[model samples]
Target chain A: MLEVKGLMVFYENALAVNDLSLKVQAGQVVGVIGSNSAGKTTLMNTLSGLILDQRIKELRKGGERITIMGKVIHEGQDISDMPAYERVRLGIVLCRERHPVFPDSTVLENLAIAGHLRSKVEVAQTTELCFDLFPNLTRWRRRKAGFLSGGEQQMLAIGMALVVRPRLLLLDEPLLGLSPAMQEKVVEAIRSVREKTGVTIVIAEQFARPILPMLDFGYVIENGMLTLTGSGRDLMENPEVKSAYFGL
Target chain B: MAAQDTSKQVTRRRERLDRGIKVRSEDIYALNSWREALYLLAPRALPVVALVLLQLLAPEYWQRVLISTTVFALLAISWDLAASSGMVCLGQALFFGVGAYLAGIMNHYLGLPPGLTLPLATLGGGVICTVLLLPVLRLRGIYFAMFTLILPLMIERIIEATKVFGGTEGLSGLTPFSHPLWESFLTMTALWVALFGLRRIMASDYGLVLKGINDNDRAVMSAALNIYRYKAQALFLASATGAFAGAFMTHSYRFVGMPVFALDYSILPIASAAVGGLGTLAGPALGAFILVPLSEMLRGLGGLRIVIYAVLLVVFTVGLPEGVFHYLRRKYTQFERWTEVGK
Candidate 1:
């Protein structure tokens, strides 16, 4: 449902996402696996059109110049210059890296805030779906999102993104800083999300072991350039992928 | 191959690089060459020389304006210091009022000269201000700002109600500087000294601790440092500069009163700092020099003066948020050119 062609992102002089390209089909679990500083977050930001917002802010403050050169096509329409909010309206929602939730808001309130565009009935239905999908969040519905554990916060973040009822969901390092047990729970939740809602999801992560088996298709990126592309099982067995990501 | 073909298209990006001399002079080797040494000194020395020259050339009325400008400039520097050190102060008047009152009281009651009154009032005012603000030092962000905003108004009310230190009428006919030149000379000296001194302090290790406290006091605390003590020290330094300005102005006008704590004294410095740039001690001072003089020049506008003045400020803040000094500094130190990407 999403196509990135010759995507090049520059933060000042540093080339973040080199002239790289990728595609994600509808209802598919596409994974972009890379180590630290592999431009994973930059790629996610570029796809969601958040980079455009950052570019304007940085320009106004006379900070580092951000140059984006590429086309982001969603369902055959060019969304390269579209702002982040507009992209969201087009049902391209991004759950950004780090468990970023409104610290002061309760879990329910956080979900409600994310579902602002939807009808009250739609929002209520999705909120129930989110709590059901991530059962850990149900107990903390009234508790502040900030007080939630890292794993619980991650669940809340994903659930918050799901509340938007996105056609194409982009998850940036969703399992970051979570324990092995929590990672398994998140991976299970991702599996159930696709099974139930059939949402097209693009997950950018460094932890390949938990996600690789679940991904229908996987792309290995190193230093902002796409290095390998294959089925999840094929990547799991690959020697290079084994050593770099799986730490064999 | 298709990506390679697309990448071949010419795309230019503006590349900024530091000047060769700027890089060279950053090293100790710069001291060996007179050119590099002169390059470093020229920016610093020229301003000092210009201020002196302007004092001699300007008419008496303008000189008086210059003195008041210097006072505002000093207050601006203090504001910048407090802001950079993580204390967003809204009541520069608190410091100014305390110092003015102290100087006025000392001069009027004790029959002290400008020299004795100025130093005593500056230090004493700083101490008093620091003690008063000590309770709210732990309050972060808007809470602290709100407390400071109320302080001067509270003090004004107290003075009015108690009728202490001449109250509404205020203490007047205090000792002025013996010579007009001495007034300008002292103010100019204080301005440069405070500017350079604060800049030097900010560059030191102590300044790093202060800055660290501002950035993340918890992180600084994790490193086993007492953030409160550091904050207190920063508060003392900032208030001292503000108090000095107040003391100087008191002697210059030969009067001190409730008007010392006026919102003009509080706001002018912040506006100057915002226009000039914050963090850089000299930048706020430069801002004051520009803003104060500009305001005086706009006096012809009469009723429309503030309207035009405020509009220009909004324009500067919105159009050039980086402030004049930072922009000028970047331009002076670096050169930019369009360069082809991925060539």
Candidate 2:
């Protein structure tokens, strides 16, 4: 389980994630849906500790020494301000949505590249499990990641992240650019993963339409704020949610 | 009928490609344009090649031409380090001369043979270069190139003013290899071996990390790799290899001087890599062969080869900066990317 509290981030003076807090219980899938400029990516980047603020880079001439503080309790350990790799080692992984596989590498190489932080993922078992999960992958096992189709790439990315056997899986827009058939396939894969591993997942999506039924709890982040939070089914029928997304 | 014919044609094409067939497509033309990078080093080597061929035909110039080619190749290989890293270094001759002089000084003044003196001096030169790299490695773009250039220029002036290496003329006639032909062969072997080692390193994972840094610094760091260390390591390896070539040059030429460490020598390797193709294992050698011979032709015209050199460099850097090997590599990488993107 992962617990986030009073999480706030800034790009110099511009606040990106404004006083936001959220949590994912053990073995549960929590989805975050937001419109464009809703700070979904910023929140994810901040959480993963790859903060690149153009404002902070350019505007600040002198160090006012602005400090950021947040408490991230993961498996009952405080990991706020922890280095990114350390977070990776603690069974926390992020699948950067549409971009997961290193296109320069082979399909097998891309899949193997993940779980690098996990002290060990015996080459044989990892290959076996990954191949079994996506049968389409075996044919292009020697092919480069750059040669893969959208659905295949998505599968490769998800397969790569899941191989790490993380306690917390942060998937950012995993379904983006995927076809309808592949979308169902991805959902099926996520379900199977949840069934097998009980890994806590924080999947941020653009809309709540497709993923709402799968999540136990959900939040609708709007204009850099966590505007609404509720049980998944309740939020699905919420007027504001329907109006903003779901095209109701 | 069309479907059967098309499938058969496709199969035939595939078989031809497998049989080392040359496809005369636009891709090969692009590949050839990249191969034209041989102009970079031809300035250093072409004269030697021509001279050697002339000597072979005319009776006794083989030794001199062979000696000249090896020197140019060694110098070019030394400079290849900077060019391949996408960093312009102008102080390579400084390291090359330092290695040459160190080994020369010890051999001539202290009676050390090429065997003991050469490797030691090369290692010493590499150490000195690593120290220099510590400060200059922080710089990027022109500043980096300038600082690297400044080192050799400053050293050359100092050596001249201080009456070091016989004050500009330098120590001479101390054979690193006793015979001219032996020296040529040894030095040539050393250059190839050094290049072989370097090429292996350049094609490895860590080398790819350097390319990643050159491509996208933030992305590389985000992947949790050290950028500073990578830069330093690359420069260190380059310096060491340059020093090795320089040490071998001392024995072959039987001389070590400030002039040997001049801008001409410093920039030769860059030209070679540009012509041969940056990051290619054999690019510098190829470039050196092409360019060195042209230097002699320029000498006949009162050093007008520089104009040729400048023109070729501008044309290569402007029109074909990737060099032959890289251009070909990029084409394949692009073609593969296109295939993927299409799907």
Candidate 3:
């Protein structure tokens, strides 16, 4: 389970996330849905403690000053000030947007690099699970991740998150730039992930139509403020959600 | 989630904003007020006044030091110009040596005066250097840098082996400036002209194209502009300034030798630019001013001079990576204050 309390992020004078908060229960597929510039990525970065690293770097380079005011509690532990790597050790893994992979490394190597902290047997089991869940990746296990198509890269990114054996996997814009068919395949992969492993997942996406059907609970954020929160079925039927997200 | 408890904890963040004078001076309306007008003129004017005073008042040895400093400053300016156009030139001495040799040849063989030789060498040396480097213009980043780095060394070897233009002995007792004041005046004139002229050019549309090339040559190429031609023009302009420094130094020393192509000429300019700041034309000049004097002051340390000098460079680079000018500029233009947030 994860809880965010009064999470406010500021890049210099610009209010990126303005006093926004949300929570995810264990084994629940939680969706934080927002359009572009809606602070979805900022929220994900804050939750994963990447903003801390960014803040220090910007400070060193005398660039934009980033300020965060919030308490990120993971299973009742205050992880607000935790570093990104330590948060990763705590099983809070974030598959950042844009399908980031080691462009020079093959798919197998990327997965192997991700699971460096795990035992050999555990890595082997997860690698098998990754290949099983995404059969499209099986043939290209030795191919460079850069050469893989965008959809394949997206799947590989998710598989990479899985390789880390994350307790809380945060997917930031997982369906970004993907075709409709690819979206369905990724949505299906998420469903199977939860059904088989029961991993708690938080997906921040702008495309609500494909993702809303899978989320047990969803929060609609606009301009870093939570606009709506309801169950998947409830949100799917809601006229406001339909008009705003589906362009009904 | 309840908001009442969160509202109780109000956090304060430090906010930075430009000073009123800086903002006001950004507009032509600032000309109405003397304070804003003075603010605009001060940073530009102070340097001119300081350099004049330094030349006139400093002791004889320091005055001689000032000439060499000016030479280095001119070279640093040239380096900054080349770097601004996306060319990381590592062989400024190529421009220097070419101009020195050309000026030395004209004065010795053709019976030319300092006046004729300086101008001829400055322009001629630039053309020669540009032609020499033209073949390698297609290379980018470190490739270009590596090519430029080897050129002066290669030329030095060729001249030594071929035994041309007096070879290692070089051309000596060629000419001297009529007066130290005249020499100081001429070098200062060249320095200011190059500094202000390049700054003006960079602020223009042509400079924008050059900067665009630096940012993304592909994007500039897509816009139907010939980036290579623009890069060559920038190279010529940069090399001309470097050549002028070399030509001037030859007459000042009354000698043009293999030492003209030494690594110190190439490396010192870069170090000055790094310490003073890159991109800004004035920053590199300021860097040369600081570094040259600092090197002189550290002369008492004898062998430790280089060690202390290097340590200071590392300290400056690590502690204030933004460079002193940028840091001071920021302090001058902006003010920061802590303000409450989340309420």
Q: Judging by DockQ, tell me the better candidate of 1 and 2.
A: 1
- Steric clash count of candidate 3: 0
Q: Which residue window of length 10 is worst by lDDT in model 2 chain A?
A: A58-67
Candidate 1 vs candidate 3, lDDT winner: 3
lDDT of 1 at B78: 92
Q: Model 2, which residues run further than 4 Å from truth?
A: A1-248, B1-63, B314-319, B326-343
lDDT of 2 by residue, B228-249 (tens): 7887777667777677667777
lDDT of 3 by residue, A21-120 (tens): 7889999999998999999999999999999999988876667889898799999999999999999999999999999999889999999999998988
TM-score of 2: 0.48
> How do all models score by TM-score?
0.97, 0.48, 0.92
Highest-TM-score candidate: 1
Cα deviation at B280, candidate 2, in Å, is: 1.7
Report the C-alpha lDDT of model 1 over B201-253, residue by residue, as the tens digit: 99999999888888898999999999989889889988988998899888888
Q: Runs in model 3 with CA error above 4 Å?
A: A118-128, B1-6
Cα lDDT of model 2 by residue, A137-166, tens digit: 889998989889988898888888877777
Chain A TM-score, cand. 2: 0.88
